[model samples]
Each structure stands twice: as structure tokens, then as C-alpha cells.
Target: MARAPVLAAGGIVLRRQATPLIAVVRLRKRNEWVLPKGKLDDGETPRAAAEREVLEETGHEVSVHEFLGTLVYDSGGRCKVVHYWRMEAGDEPAYELMYDIKAVDWLPLEDALDRLSREHERAFLENVGPIALKAAALDGAARRKAAKPATRRPRRTVAPPPSVSEPDTVPAQFDAQVTQEEPRSTTEAAEPAISAPAAAESQIPPSFASDIEPVVIDAVPMRPSHASRRNLIQRVRDWLRRAA
Candidate 1:
């Protein structure tokens, strides 16, 4: 009997920056890095699955934007079809992973293009590379454009500084112009006005002894063996291992 096709959905969760970045996830056991994706559950829509899987696998809450394309291939005697969408990630840390996902990386567009394992994924990305980059970068100059304008484009050159033929001592000239506009008092002109925070603090009322409450926080007693510190160190190590 022929193996049934498994339907799944995923996202290329991206963040807009100086260089557009795409989020990729690593499996804990296999140590393979790939785009966040998962099999669709019963009654789950492709877009919904894509958003859900991204959050679950990568812990990033992404807003689904444009649909890239479906990648269909045979794996382990079963045909798998993954529908991918371009998504924008929120400016927040991902939720905690369930330990299956080891690490999440937000790599630049070109780096991510090279990072993806599958050739089909690479090809699909290459096919929609320009559009994907344009969508990822919401600006005109930042967009990964393939076709140049019909007219010959001029190379960007640094602008020349303006030549100023003014009177000698520009600082003295500015001082004279300022004096002409506003006349300062003899004392004001003699010394610069120094503002102090203490003047503002005077506005605040002084605290009284009656405002302080007589309360005590119970402190836990430590054992002579320092078992708590050892446990804490081990826990920190475990957390670090998982994070790495």
C-alpha cells in the first residue's frame, strides 16, 4: 500500500532590521537546524497551523503575512507537504519550548538562505527571494530587488560641504548676534546660571520617623553544609545546558 501524504504548515518568521532576519529552529536530539514547522491537527487551517507551529517550535508569536509556497517531498516512506508563509515576529522573547526544540536563531536573509538544509527549500526561497526580502523589509532601499530601474541609476555619492565666506571668529560673531537680540543683566552675563537638583528636592516634604513601620521579615536559616547553594548551582547549570 502507498504511504499517505502528510499535510503540514510552517513559517519563515522574520524581523525587520538593518538586515532582514529569518527565525530558524534546531531539534534537540538530532541537532538539525530548520525552519519552524509541524504537522496539521484535525480541523486546523494551514495559516493557523503555521502560526501555531512557529510559536510552539520556536516560541515566537508571528503574524502570518504572504504565503510562500508548498514544499512536497518523500520522507521515511511518507510524502510530506509543508505550506510555508512569510510572517513578521513580535518584539518579544519566545515562550518556553517543550525541550524538543533546542535553540532558536534569527539569522540574516542571506545567511538563512544558506542555512536551510533542503535544496527544495533553498530553491523556493531563491525563486521568491526578491519578493520575500521586499516583504521582510518594509522600506524601498532595503528591499532585495532583482530588476533595476529602466533608466540608468546614478551611484550614490557623498554630498560636498557648503563653503562659508564669513567674518573672522565665527564664535564671536554668534555672540554679538545673540547680544543684539536679547540683553542680559550684568550678573547674568558675569556668571552662567547653574541649576541644581537640590532646589527641586526642597519642594518634597521631609520623611518623619512615624512614617516608618516596625516590621520584620523572617530570614531562613542556612544549614552548615550549604546544600541550598549546591542545588542552586546545579539548577543553573541545567538551565544553561538546556539554553545552549
Candidate 2:
């Protein structure tokens, strides 16, 4: 008898704070509150397969930020190990219309803890909670780092305010400015408006109208010739002579 190959996958149930902590779907159909997961497909790494399965099973978009932990279990006498990861779900599920997901709902973290059925589920909740919190703290520190403005050298002393007497010279400057502006404005006024030109007229000749419009021709009736009438009378006369 051949030994069965060990099957492996990964899952992460998410919980957000609310009246009830919102954890990911507990699939009643699958009988597990598993983060969407499946066996590693041929040529696919365990971690990549885990992420792909989660996205397929749950319509939610998720990014795998870090590896969480692993769970060992059994299915049909085969040993299975599931390696988990912490991923953030996008606000909207990218694959909701896909058929694999029967349904999804968010439950409170506490409620999820109380309701989760698997032993691995308990372990994951415990292990991942602290890791996630730590990850969150690290994220906070990074954000703080980003928010801190870079140290800038003291700005060079600003030049003293322009003299108040400059306003009296405005008339002289305005005359020169208007003389420069008038010709440019007049030239700009001569530019064309930016609408599409009307369509060109069709180039077809008037003689081609007969092809365009359907034309009906009357049929001429057939007429018998004078020779045929004479031949008929001669045949009748020959028949009378033969009878006599």
C-alpha cells in the first residue's frame, strides 16, 4: 500500500473591534471558520497557494504581510499541515461574484473565540492576536517616523519689505505693460474656434441614382406571327381535300 502524501494549506480568520469583533466567514458548508485555504496545487508554493485559496474562497482582497503559524490536522486518514499568514483584507471583496464562496460575514473577535470549533483555531487566535498587535505597534512607529518632518536649515533672512514709495511708480510700469499686452491680445482674438468641421458632401454622380433607388421594369407580352396563322389555315384546307 502506498502512503498518502501530506496535504498542506493556510488560513487566517480576521477580527475587527465592534459591538462584536468581526472575524471572517465561518463556512457552515465546510464546517470550519477557516481563513479560506486549500491543498497546495502542483508547482505552487504552500504560502502562495494559501493566499490564492483565501482570495478565491472569500471574495475579500487580502495581502499576506507575514507568516503567522501552522496547524496540523487529519482528513480521511491523511496527515495535513496548514501554514498560516497575517493578511489585510481590502475594504471591498474583489471576487464576490465567484462561485466558491457560499457566504461571508464578520463576527466579533470575542464571539469568534467563543464560537470557533477547531483546536488549531484556538491556537491561531491566541498566537496571531499578539503578533498582530505587535505588527500594529511596529506600523505605528513607522508612521510616526514618516510623519516627522525632515530637519531643514534655518531659512536665509528674507529681504527687507519693498519700499512703500514703489506704488507711485505703478503708472510708468502699467503704460509699458499695456503697450506690450495689446498686440498679443489682438492676435489671440484672431485664432479660430475649436469645433469639428461639418462632414463633406457625398461624391456620387446623379446617374448612379438609378442604382440607389429600386427601379421596376414592365414585362412585354408574347405575340404569334402571321406565318403561323397562314400555316393553320392551309392544314385545315388539306384535311377537307383529303375527306372529299
Candidate 3:
């Protein structure tokens, strides 16, 4: 009867930089450098196992992304199948390295491939390294674009209020008619008459008429003159004579 394959999971963990770096861990017992990976725990999914294993081996918290590829090979006469995912590490490590791991190295793709002890793992990285680096570079660019502040719109210039024009000048003839008062002679008893020009000047245009106030006369009692008193007495005497 054929035995079932040993299930394992891991990550192609990257530290983002100008040029992204990959992580490879050195084993304590075997003293061999290999990709950070481990066997899946009971009831754990491949993705969860990959994230946990990479964190333990690299000591850095990571953000898991899309699935990479799977590796199937013979390990101690047993079929071992390992699943991988793309992951990004934070700037610093969050935990100590696992007891089984001696050290973790962050290296370029070529160096990581060359440093890896297993042939299958090296070949896998070489196949997928460029893909991971390209994705990381593109992701960095997108993040920078999103983080950039938006350009401000220029302020609109408000025009100043229009200047008030000088009030319309009253014609010289109209001014004379308004301000000049004719002097009356003591012997002249007749009321002053308005001339035609004065009447025409009084008919001010509607635009200027709005500024003029109407003249008002108050009703007042006047004392009778000597001539008026003499006329009244004569009228009274004539009426008395007629009655008699």
C-alpha cells in the first residue's frame, strides 16, 4: 500500500525596499539554509500554516497575499508536498526565531536561490522570484500613488465692487430757481407770480425729482391790517342804516 504525502506550507516572504528581498532560514539541527516552511498542524489550513510558519521562522509579522506554487518531492522515502504563498514582512521582527531555526537571512533573489541548500527549493525560487519582485514593485508604486496628497485648486479672485458715480449735477438754471428769492418792494401789494421759465424749471426730471421734498404750508391766523379794519366798520355802519 502507498503512503499518503506529508502536507507542509510556507511563504515566499518579501521585505519591501528599493529592491525587494527574500527570506531564507538556516536549520539548527541540519545546519542547512532553506525556505521558511513547516508541516501543517491538525485542523489548520495551508494558508494559515504558511503564515504561522513564516512568522516563527523569520520572527517577523507578515501580510499574506496570493498563492504562489506547490513543491512535491521525496523526503526520507516519504512524499512531501509543500504549498507556498506570497507574503510581505514588516520593518522589524515581532518575535524571536524558532528554536529549530538558527538564523534568518534577507537576501536578493539570486543570493537567496544560491544560498538555499535544497535543489528543489532553489529551482522553485528561481522560477518564481521575478514574479514576486515585479508584484512587489508594482504594489509599492500603487501605495505611493495612494498616499500622495491631492493638488489644491487655485482660489477664485473676486472683483471689487463698482465705484459709486458722482451724483447728477442740477442745471445752473434749476439751481438759480431753487436758491434765488425775489425781493418784494414795500409799496407793491400784489402777490408774486411764477414766470414760464420758473414753471419749466419746477418740472424737474423724475431722476432728480426723487431728491426734492414737497413744500408744505401751515394754516395760521393773521392780525387784521388798519385798511381791513376800516372796511369792516364801514360795512357794519351801512347795514345799520338800512335796518333803521
Candidate 4:
């Protein structure tokens, strides 16, 4: 025959003062300080019952995070499994205690670890201790930051104070741009803005003749041929013989 397991829920509830403390409650009948855990009511979820139980037993409002596994042990003939969470307690529970809880006290987590009656509960604390410690440290840091006053940052300096000459030059340039007076019109009109080569070209005189020969190499007539010289000599000899 299989044994039916009893389901229960509770928390590792932490509250911070100078240092963070875990909430461990003393049981009236058992005369032991243990993490608060109880069997679920009809139609109650483990998480919901855990929250309700902590409120009822310890009188502290808690916001729970991380379902921190379970512990199962045989109680007499029946097996029992208890689920746990890492819960952060608020200012007030706003509810009255109504069960086996005699007193709930916040003690340093290390002390509470040692104080827990069950070895199983202490093992659970050991597993989740680092996470709880980190949360507490972060919470403490945030509170410190919030409480600290904000400081005003110093204004940035830019350009240094202007020199006397710099101020004088600025007005001179401004006056020259905005209301600059031109000198009285002179006999020589303002010179045209032209390149040096272009000005030289404009100064050159225009040529009238189109086919003029250059002074360096003049044109000349063709020289006499050898045939013309020989013909002239023969004509002279014939004329002299006839006259004699």
C-alpha cells in the first residue's frame, strides 16, 4: 500500500534593519524555534497558503519570490512534503496570530540557521543563504542611495575673458561690414579686377595688314640659269664678226 503525502508551505522570510534578519517562529506545543510551515486548507494553493500562513502565524506581510524547492519526511506513518519560498517582509503584517506560533522574532540569518530545529530546514537555508544575503545587500544599498542627498555639479567654463584688442577688433569688423563709408569718388575710377595675362592682352595694339612678311626673313626673286648665260655669250660673238 502506498502512503499519501501531506502537502505544506512556508517561507524564509527576511527583514532588514542594521543587518538583515530571518523570521523564525517558536512553536507553542513543540517548544522549538523553526521556520513557520503548515498543512494547506481545502482548495488552497501551496503559495497562497504559505502567504496566508506566514501572515496568520507570524503577523508579517510578505512578498514571496523563487519557489525554493521542498523537503519531505515521514511524520509517524504518513509522509509530509513542505514547499518553501524566499519571502521579504514589509512594515506590518496587519493580521493577528491564530495558531501554534507562540512568538516570531527576527534574528541574523546565520543565527537562525543554527536555531532551526530540523536539519532538513537548516540544509534548505544553506542552499538559499547566498541568494538571501545578496538580496539583503542590494536592498541595503538601494536604501542608502535613496537616503543620501543629491549634490550639485559645478558649472562648466568655456572661452576665457576677451582681451581689450579682441573686443576693439570685433566692433571694427562689424562696423566695416554693416555701415562702412566709401571714400569720395576720385578721378581714377576703381581698377578692374582682371588676371595679369588678360591685362597684357588688352594693352597690345591691333595689326591692319593681313599678308605682311616678317622683318627677320624677307622674300627675293629666283637666280639666273646657266642656259641663259651661255645664250647671251654666243649672240655677242656673232654680232662682233659681222661688224668687222
lDDT of each: 0.75, 0.61, 0.85, 0.76
- Could you say which candidate leads in lDDT? 3
> Can you give the lDDT of residue 224 in candidate 1?
64
lDDT (Cα, tens digit) per residue for candidate 1, span 33-104: 788899999999999998898899877677788898888888788999999998888767668875889888
Residue-level lDDT of model 3, residues 13-62, one tens digit each, is 99987768899999999999999999999999999999999999999999
TM-score sort, best first: 3, 4, 1, 2
Question: lDDT tens string, model 2, 66-172?
Answer: 78777776767877787777766655667752464556666555555666667766767766766765674575579789999999899899899888675654587
RMSD of candidates 1 onward, in order: 42.0, 37.0, 13.9, 18.0
Q: After TM-score superposition, what is the CA distance of residue 149 in candidate 4 from its true location, in Å?
A: 10
The C-alpha stretches of model 4 lying farther than 4 A from their native spots are 139-244
Highest TM-score model number: 3
Q: In terms of TM-score, how similar is model 2 to the real structure?
A: 0.53
Query: Which wins on lDDT, candidate 3 or candidate 4?
Result: 3
What TM-score does candidate 3 get on C-alpha atoms?
0.64
Model 3 residue 22 CA deviation in Å: 0.9
Regarding TM-score, does 1 or 3 come out ahead? Answer: 3
Please say which candidate is ahead in TM-score: 1 or 4.
4
* Candidate 3, position 160, lDDT: 95
Candidate order (lDDT): 3, 4, 1, 2
